[model samples]
Structures are given as structure tokens and as C-alpha cells.
Target: MQINGKTAISYHYFQRIKESLTFAATVAALLLTQLRVALIMSLVRYFKLINIFQVLFKLFTIEFGIDSSGSALDLANENIVLNELNQGKVSFVKGDATTFMKGAISENELWDLVILDPPKLAPRKKVLQSASGMYRSLNALAMQVVKPGGLLMTCSCSGAMTQSGMFLKTIQGAASMAGRKVTVLRQAGAACDHPIDPAYPEGQYLSNYLLRVA
Candidate 1:
């Protein structure tokens, strides 16, 4: 029913997913789900959150671009365990996230949910401009792939980025450009383990939103 984080100072992320995704008339319709859980840095997996999807749906898929794989420490077997865990239930594919999204649109591929967790793009303030452009285009493509009334979980882990407004605007712009209206159901931030200290502004590096594409 809830996703409790690993640490003693855990956070509950169940509401984030529960609010964003809307189930269709049949519970079986939830089979085609997609969860990009947590950060997109090397396509990390928060099993605590991922299990929520497992318990609720089936025949789902996950997207992690070929470029976004592996940590410096486990270059050879970084994804082995995650892949093994999701082997039969979810399809884990490698490709360009934006490109795959656009391709899915053209191919008329749709899903019950689309989770978008991009990497920490604007790490430095100087590159925020380029990161903004990337955010717009990426969301636009994502909008095209989501089925009507489906969900979108977009996240930003760029510490330099604004804590509010900019992200919603970028996604809203994408919806406009895609000729679809996506509603903002709710907004949230880092898990408890990744807390934001009042004293250190730069310590905040995450912003997430639960959206519904209509």
C-alpha cells in the first residue's frame, strides 16, 4: 500500500504514484505500465518504490536509454540484479528516451503510464539554458507517447534548477506544443533520506510532479 524507503529516516512515496496514475474501467488495463522510478542517473532502481508497481500491475515496461547505464564501480554488472528482478514482469529496454518516445508516438504505441526521470542536467548554472531546451523537447515527446488520461511522473535532480514554476512551465509548454492538455495533479520533492537542509540551499536537488495527460 505504501513505498517506505530503505533508511531509518524513510519517506513515503506511495501517494506520488497513487495520485498520478488513473486506472481504467478494468483493473486488467493496468498491465501496460511504465515506471522510471527515482533518478535517471544510470537508470537507478528504487525497489521500494518499484514494488508498488509490481503489486498493482503486470506486463509493464521500463525505459532507460543506452547512454544511461552503469555506475563507475559496477560497469560490468550494474543492471544485472535489477534486470533479473524485473525479468518476466517488466520489459527493460535500451534506447534513446526522447527518440523512443517520439518513435512510439509515430508507431501509435501507448501505455497506461509514462514515468520520466531525467538525469541531473543543469548541474552548473551556466548550462541551465541548454537543459531547459532539453526539458521542453523531452516532455513534448513524452506527451505524444502517453495515452489519453494516462500519467506522467517527471523529475528533475538538478540542484541549480529552480525549486518551482520552471518545471511545470516546461511540461505545460510541451503539452501545448503537443496539442494536449496535461493536468498537474500534485507536486513533491526528495525522499526523506534525501532531505533538504534549510541552511544549505544547494543541498536541494530534486523536484517531482504527478501529471495526467488528457
Candidate 2:
């Protein structure tokens, strides 16, 4: 075959075009196969076939128990508090500590025990100052509701707020605002199930303190 120069160039161009088309088709086919596999896996999981093992593992491996808060019960539990008060143990109030101290309850109406488990005041370091203000305000109000010899259980779950720093500042701020003296009774942390990994101190989120407001 006698091929001219222009004809040879045309043949080379056609070959390159064919190779490009073949590569594109291969990539498209691979993607479609992956999508089909993903769809099948999703359907299996949705139908509970793949989740059956997880369900069985949880059912057989997990054990549950009811924690008994003996004679010295948590006054926050409505049923327990009502039951105790009915049995002539102690009285209780169902209200927010912050609002309750701010004249929500009469001055004569005082509580023997108070629990301040407010929500997370600061989720990040940037909001720590604002969160501290909220904590101080709340504690100030709480101080008014507690009797002279009453017990106060104040707590915070803000990881950004250190335990010693936030707790001491809260007591100081509340005392300064309400013009009351607070005595520290005890300090505590989370229960067993919520263990704090030494490597990850952020895992320890809860800080609880028992104080006497006078």
C-alpha cells in the first residue's frame, strides 16, 4: 500500500483517539461496578441481614442493673424525693436552681438540699468566658435558695472549663454576688462506666462539688 504523508498522520491520529476512548470506557465500567457493590451492601444492611450479628452481640454481651441510691438518696429524683417526703424523710422542690433562687420561691421557702446540674455552659474554649458568666449567675441564684446549713451539689460538664478553675471561680463568684459564705464539702467525678483515659484528659467532662451554703 502506498500511503501519502497526510494519510499516515491521519492514521496515527485515529489510533490515539481509539486508545483514549478505550481508557475512558474502562474507568466508567470500574466505577459502575463499585456503585453496584455499594448498592448491594446497603440493601443487605437495610434489610437487617448484616446487622443481625450486631444485635445478637449486644443482647448476649451486655448486662443491665438498677442503681440503688440507699438511704442518702439524690434529692433530684422526683419520685424518690416525693416518696421520701411522703415517708417523712425530707422535702423537695421541682424547679430550675437559677430561676428558683431569683425569687421564684419565697424567702421563707428554703431547701435543705440543692442540685445544680446545669447544661454545658461552654462547648469550646472561645465561649469559656461567656459560659463562666452563666455559671456565676446560676450559682448566685442557687445560693439564695439554699438554707443557711443546706447542702449544694453543683456540677458542670464543660471540658473547656477546668475542674479546679471553674469550680473555685463559681464558688467565689456566687459568694461575692450573693454575699454568702460557701464551705467545700467534697469533690467528685463521673461513675465507673464513664472512665477517663489518661491519654485523653478531655474524656473527663463532668465536675461535681458538694458545698455548704451559709
- Candidate 2 residues 89-189, lDDT tens each? 22333333344456534654444345555667788878988888888887777666665645556667788776436767767898889787897766666
TM-score of 2: 0.54
lDDT string for model 1 (88-142, tens) is 4334444467666667788987654556767778888888778878888887877
Candidate 1 ranges beyond 4 A from true positions: 1-44, 47-50, 56-67, 70-86
Cα-based RMSD of the predictions, in order?
6.0, 30.6
Q: Would you give me the overall lDDT of model 2?
A: 0.48
lDDT of each: 0.56, 0.48
Which residues of candidate 2, in runs, are more than 4 Å off?
Answer: 1-97
